[model samples]
Target: MASDGASNNERLLAAARDDNEDLLLDVFDQPGTFDINYQDGLGNTALHYAVLHTSYDVLDHILSHEECDVDPTNKLDKATPLHLAVEKEDPEDREYFVENLLEAGANYTIRNKHGETAEDLVKPGDEVILALFRKAQADADANMDDIAYEDDDDVASEGSD
Candidate 1:
């Protein structure tokens, strides 16, 4: 069951690279196709792969699923999906994606095993990106009460004003 699950997850990730948003929706609509946060060999979820490849549609699909948390940390790196996106994307993109992730309930202030917060990964004083980062941070801090992911894999977030 475990390896089958793993192989299925690998397929899901490949679909993400192909930018097939429907694949995840299909999985979610099925009886029990995914563990939602399941990781493959390198501690990456379908979420991570989607972001790595900049599959915007797939990213949207995963974020829309109630069974997936926006802040799920990879087991080996203890890095959230947001963290991986920050590391992999360019600065402007990192800011926008991080804001979406935070508003979706990622704890933006949290660091990984490398002691690097998403904020730290960004270069200092890159104005356009910095503004968005600050906006995201402020939004995250203010909405702490409004953003939450339940232990049972439920995701609910604040209405952005």
Candidate 2:
């Protein structure tokens, strides 16, 4: 039974590397296929392979899984999927990936082996992506402030009672 699970996971990893979106979806939809965060020999989850292969469709499928770890780091560089997305060859694709990852709750503060966060990976010339990063940071700050305010309000009301 254990070997069966291992083989199934291997097949899933192969599908990921080949950009086989259909097979990936098929396998993931089945029962007891593999852990959503399963790591291959190189410490990469299926999502990491999808990003490495530039398979946006597969990336979407993996991300759609409720248990998927958006911040997984591979063995080579301890780089998350967002790190790879930031370096995509096409500017539009790079921005799209970055935004999607952010919306999915990707942590921009997680650093890689080089001690660089996803925001630090943005190229100097990619103005659009840079702007998106700034916006994400600002939004995050605003959300945190809102939560803090709510907490304070709760405390004040309790004290007044």
For all predicted structures, in order, the TM-scores are 0.72, 0.85
Q: Per-residue alpha-carbon lDDT of model 1 for 75-108, expressed as tens digits?
A: 7778887777677547656665665676677667
Tens digit of lDDT per residue, candidate 2, span 44-106? 987777777776677777788888899999999999989998988888778778888887888
- In model 2, which residue pairs have backbone atoms overlapping below 3 Å? none
Q: Give candidate 1's whole-model lDDT.
A: 0.68
Q: Highest TM-score: which candidate? A: 2
lDDT of 2: 0.82
Off by over 4 Å in 2: 1-6
Position 131, candidate 1: lDDT: 66
